[model samples]
Target: MSGQQQINFEKPFIGSIDQGTSSTRFILFDSKGDTVLSHQIPLKQYHPNPGWVEHDGLEIINSVNECISQVLNKYKETNIGEISDIKAIGITNQRETTIVWDKNTGKPYHNAIVWSDTRTSSIVNRFNTKAESLLKKEQQSQSQQQIVPKDYLRDICGLPIANYFSAVKLRWLIENVPEIDQSNALAGTIDSWLVWNLTNKKTHITDVTNASRTMLMNLATLEWDSKLCDFFDVPNSLLPKICSSAEIYGHVESGPLAGVPIASVLGDQQSAMVGQMCFDKGQAKNTYGTGCFLLYNTGDDIVHSKHGLLTTVCYKLGKDSPVHYALEGSIAVAGAGVKWLIENLGFANNSKEIEALANSVQDTGGMYIVPAFSGLFAPHWRDDARGVMVGLTHHTNKAHIARAMLESTCFQTYEVLKSMEKDSNDKLVELRVDGGMTMNDLLLQIQADILGLPVVRPHNLETTCFGAAYAAGLTVGVWSSAMQFHIGKRFTPNPNIDHMKRINDWHKAVSKSVDWVDK
Candidate 1:
């Protein structure tokens, strides 16, 4: 509704293909950042084994095509503008979701290994052991090293050796899927998968933001690292070329927006950062989605996290533009925790009912939930952690558990924010939030209460899509500069509540969740 400003027939529009973990959406936005037309399709997730998550690669492309067709049809019905008025398309997707396919026939060797999948935990452990052995050999030959083996590549790739990244996922495919090899296979994240399919298999490229998450790209050089490839045992030839986040990559081969330049590509979290207009250093934004991601803009300099946070590329607007960097804290469970409440615990019928249920209670009555369903990410990269709901009693009912569920996300954000503050050495004045979870006012207030920082939601909650739209729009001159959207809601922290005690209790609950699965 915020984008309902008078539609100028003369102005051009931009389209963003948001390929998330659970859904795919095609959104058409005018120069003013108004939604001209949009369509979304829910994606199916497959779990053939516990700790494994996947998506059909072909299904993802098909869903994108379907969304594009539906949105274009709606645009035609409205007669707002001709399809030709859409200048370019941008893509923002779930980072670290690995897909491998044949370069010639474009048939996937296996389902896309989703970012949330932990089937590669064994692979991670092996790599960590190998790294430690290598480090021991070096230490015996030279001076003792201070750094841990798991963080051996952090200086180069800005990521820990964990299963949450693309390298390990790619490694698992290479080892497990026998057919995949350098001869015919091409591998990359979802952005590469979509671009290759959209351009009729002509363009095979991934942007800097997506490349950073692969844990194989050199953050300084912005290219695939040979050492990392060797470490993961993945052939460099099987990977796509790395490019800047905003540039004309190629044209869509067919459909309603045929021949339109595919101008930009960013991992979803980085796209949200751009959409939030957090260009200045020290600015930060949190996206509450399937998982929660808080990114603190560090401008051009890449600040290595002394804490457990990650240093990553925020965005590169064009090939010539300077690469902006950021400190990122990733929580693997946020909205997924809510979904677990609905489907597993049977708390309510839908997520919207969660707020009402949470609000019905005054407090959680000392209850605390650590939703470490797939281990814990950021600040605590514990793969052994499991879901735990502590401080339960006879008085604790559905409402208390529901409130604790919501508070779990807030508490996770708080931990990430604290780590980010220490890593960046800049205290954030406020946190700009976006995504579906921000729609819940009670959640935002709880977030503010927990973090003791103002939580600001944009007038348009579609920042992830709009961030991609902004990148593409800027490239095609749909807009000369980034358009600023007004704030929709702001929740200030309550001074009376002592948040630190609750945070400490959250840490205790988290400790209880760890080492749940025996090594």
Candidate 2:
């Protein structure tokens, strides 16, 4: 009772800018995984052609600004702050979406080549077959020449050479988009693109997680892999400087809220890993979204996969630190299958309706959908494996297709995580799950049953946003480190043994769907 005045409020608020594939979301979180104030805005997606997908870079930036502004406004209305008492900001963005801009005008040379874009499919196909083979052959032929392994799909940087990653897309831009080259286009992944814009073109930088996806950063050196860069026709000048995921890279020079420090950047998946507090070796998670991505943190050890899995960096905090790596297996389709039902098939009214339709069926009725609509990734990589459905009799209906589509997501994820465990020779007791689809109880339970492991779902399904916030919180001396970040709920594995039999039968159903696409 000695106090004449008292200031109340115990902890700090952390803001996260989650720049994702479909939209940009800004969420404010307290120490616990509680959403204090949040706002999300969907951006316009551009389809310039049948196979090409793009998002306006300026719009992406504007949307990000708006998302952050919305959350800040809500905070003010809620008595959180008219003046920011925010500790830090974390940025987790869609990896591999390539955006090139003119440094002078600070305008994107063209619409960003979203990670979903397939403009480089033919290029990737040709590289996979010919140039990659020749490089391996040459390496093997030379006796003292660090002989490359047979059938080795050479690891470019710490990443696989694919149309999904950015290096190939950057090459495509240089070769095809004349305007980009004429501008001496400065190119980067989505995170870097945002960083450049955020810092007012002062920081052309990206973190280890995002850079690792570019097919240009060496897993060991933690620098841009020059050999791979040259191979991809990506000039060193076009690349951003590599930086730690958690560090004060630059300050906000101009924006709605000026003078705030811009700290911490991670690829969306790796950021989710941070958000989930997956700080140990063998800890793994699968994000169920437009695509399902399974990443297993291998820790300091770089275990090259004997299986189809690709070796990639999980995240790195400092330059000299042991580079924690991961084995990633990606499915080209997940929520997109549900999305297709909305836009293409008219099978479901919205995302939730797809779940209802799927539940209508007791099972898929031996119908399997391999959503290779884009291409098969990891354990498959058959770009030629176009989407197909099998066991489609007159009896099959939208319910069956819906069930099969949702099943495909779990099945694909099962195959990937299965391969990761196999490749690492580690037992996967449980898998941490996130993303929009992970909200579905049926999907979560089936995911557990199909994998025969606990599928842990966090309370705040937006792990992606929290991850970035965690990083930002760390960088500004708000949070100590990644290990200190608090986590929410965990979904334990509890698949009934009876469901195991059903899962095995489901696999057989999947067999009928594979290789159905014409080469």
Candidate 3:
């Protein structure tokens, strides 16, 4: 199945660990990016306070270990291959989820702060005020000719001091968790945490793609910016040394596949971009997971956004290769909104059933659901926004709400696409899509109708995992390039519906959701 002319091997394979917000999984993939074997485990999330979300850091490590063991055990029983045949391992994780641990003990100080958590909104506000005051002081102390424009760290980091990024999360931990303030403790995102444990603490490193998500890293230098670290009050020593996305970071010191080289690492969304084979400029993909993330490849240029989108590294194959940048549009809630309907509102017995339920209704019946559950992300970075449903009448049933929920995801993605187009000035010919939600053809149709653009889904919906595997395989020469990724399905735009009215009604509902909670 490999495109390269290398000698074919029956036993050699690549392994990947996809640690996502909702679950942990270990997938064994062949050279063609097809999953040969896999084991998945659902992760438990704790919400101890309103707008707060966390995951047990140890639990994350344990889950990864368990899945790897289970997959290898099954491999052994089937006599397909030995653990030694797994040439390399790759890792992709939810970005910006902060974890602080004792450097010596390897014990986390507190639960890993999830990217969706809004506990640091107040801290972000305070930091913004401090930055403004400092800027004003500089302006007053200097003449107009001597005044230097302050880009507010955006030009360097390509991010804002928002709760979604890792810097604010790390700052919050230092203030709230005393153990974290100790000199022995170090802060890192999930990739660094997993890499540390996987290599038996022999290495503390993170890929540029993951590091870019933290506000501490400079986009151009691809290293922790001292100015940013000082502004955030986080020591540079606390961060992992940044590495390329596809180089061997370290060898696995202990596991079923002990001694296997951990060759590649990427942030989950960046992995999806690679898996989608979006290597050229203007190519884009939207992952419909717990949240919807749309990334447009801008080649090597780091195009700063006039809109609320973020500029981030897409991937860097090696230290010598040029860094590919992307414009990212994040929607806080997508599949999670469907899960909320299923578990919280009893709209369906399973997430898959939502498709049939939504299809039961001809339309939403004028209902508009604004899934601002974790506040709006991307173009509208409103921390105070809350979920709202407008045009709900007595005639509205669960089916209508279900339809509206699916439509909410589509509308949000449409808005982000518009923003991306505005910032990049390049219209998307088609959107390559992946993730669990893409399984629902009805939802994809809704997405295509709303955006008036063709939607393409890869044969392997688990591109996030495959992307990691591909990176690892590339490092070990499993395949020459990611050009092997081919389209599985395509949904063309059927823009017959009056989408303008629906979008207007959605905006009206969203307006009510803004500033819902008082400070």
Candidate 4:
């Protein structure tokens, strides 16, 4: 597998704990980004109220341990290597999920505030109205906030004070929870909490990529902006020390695989960059999980989009390493459309079935289902946009709705990618895609046709886990370089009828679905 010099067959295996919003997965990868084995466990989510999302932090930690144990145990029978030869582990997680835990006891003080949680809108309103002095401090010091002519946290973070990030969550906790307010509470995102748990509470740290999303880190400095910390009413002591994405964050002390070094912590989107091997400026990738995320590599320059896209850290190699910046956009709903179909509409029994049903229809049959369930995002930024269907005729049945649901996701991505191209002027010609929805050929084809670009999907669809494994593998000298990995597969754009006309009608359908925002 060597591009030049040959090495022995003794490459150490690297494991990754990809704790995401939907599930927890443990993936083991060899040096060349090839999967050796894997295990995944679905996580339980609590949506006790609208816009209030929570998860058990202990469940998150235990799932990681359980997956590692399961994968290692199963790998014991493989002759490729022994369990004892495993080198290290890397972690990539859904960023912005907030938690407050005891520094001494390692117990979560409350359920984690998921990245999707929108419980802090009123809190944000209060800050925007009352905390002008504090907001100014943050605006000057925080790099992302600074990128915009000020008032840019929502612009550059692809988030708002409305609670999809750690900052407002921390603010809400500190204000409402009595225990956290009066003590030295350890407050941080999922990465910080997991790093703490893994190191036996020895390391309370997070990487630059994760930090940038918090509306706390200065994009340029890659450090916690002291002013923003104060602006968000977060005590300086409560935050985690920021580090590089690829350095040794901590080491495992006690677990199914103890004593292994933990390196390469990344937000899931950034990790997918490492997985897709998007190393150059203008390279872009879109992930279709519960929601859709499009990220374009902008090199070191943070473009600070006028459109509703974010300037965030793609990855930080080290404390002193040059940070690769990215422009990111988030859609309100994607695969959640399929979930709604199954759970609410009785269209299908499972998510995988939606692909076949979507394929059954030649067209959406003049129907459109804009899934603005929570709100619209990206260039639209219409928090008022609510989920609604338009142009539904008698012929518009389950298949058409399935197709429309799938097309809705692509259109949302198309909007973001177009905005990304305009903001960075990169003109994305190809996009690497991963996550659950990429498994759908019908969806991928539609994505290709609509975007008028090649959509490359890797053989190992688990890009998030693979990226973490790659990072860890590099740190331990297992996969010395990611450049050696081969391109697994490519799904090119297919010819469609009346491209311009189809686009017009599709967009026309979209226009009708508006005005439903928050009505």
Clashing pairs in 2: 90-468, 454-493, 456-491, 457-491
**Ranked candidates (lDDT, high to low):** 1, 3, 4, 2
lDDT of 2 by residue, 1-519 (tens): 011111233357677788888889887766554566678888788987866889999999999888878766665555655446676677898888998889888888888998878778778766666555666677667743452322233454544567778878888888877777543568899888887888887899988888888778877888887677766667899888988888878877775557777777889888888878888998998899999899999988878776777777888765445567888887878998899988999996798898898998888877778778766788766555567787788889989999888888888887787788788988888888889998788898777777778788876677888888777776666667554433344545453445556557656655554565443
Q: Which pairs clash in model 4?
A: 143-218, 384-517, 384-518, 385-517, 386-517
lDDT of each: 0.92, 0.77, 0.89, 0.79
Cα deviation at 313, candidate 3, in Å, is: 0.6
lDDT by residue (tens digit), candidate 1, 388-458:
99999999999999999999999999999999888877799999999899999999999998888999999
lDDT of 4 by residue, 1-519 (tens): 111122423356788889999899888776656567788899999998987889999999999888888887776654557656778888999988999987777778889988777777777667656545555676668732433222445433434444456888888777777776336578788888888988988899988889988888888777777667776777788888988888887789896678888988999999998888887899988999988888899998878777777778898765566789999998868988898999998998987788889887799988778887776777676555567788888888899989999989988888898889889876887889998888888888888888889988877677888788787776766765556435556777767534566666656765665676332
For lDDT, the strongest prediction is 1
What residue runs in model 2 are displaced by over 4 Å at the alpha carbon?
1-10, 82-84, 129-133, 136-140, 143-156, 318-321, 481-519
TM-score per candidate, in order?
Answer: 0.98, 0.91, 0.96, 0.91
Deviation from native of the Cα of residue 283 in model 3, angstroms: 0.5
| Residue ranges of candidate 3 with Cα displaced over 4 Å | 1-11, 138-151
Among all windows of 10 consecutive residues in model 4, the one with the lowest summed lDDT is: 1-10
| Model 3 lDDT tens row, 310-385 | 9999999877778999999999999999999999988889978999999999899998899998788987888888
Return whichever of 3 and 4 wins on lDDT. Answer: 3
Clashing pairs in 3: none
- Predicted structure 4: lDDT: 0.79
Task: Output the TM-score of candidate 2.
Answer: 0.91
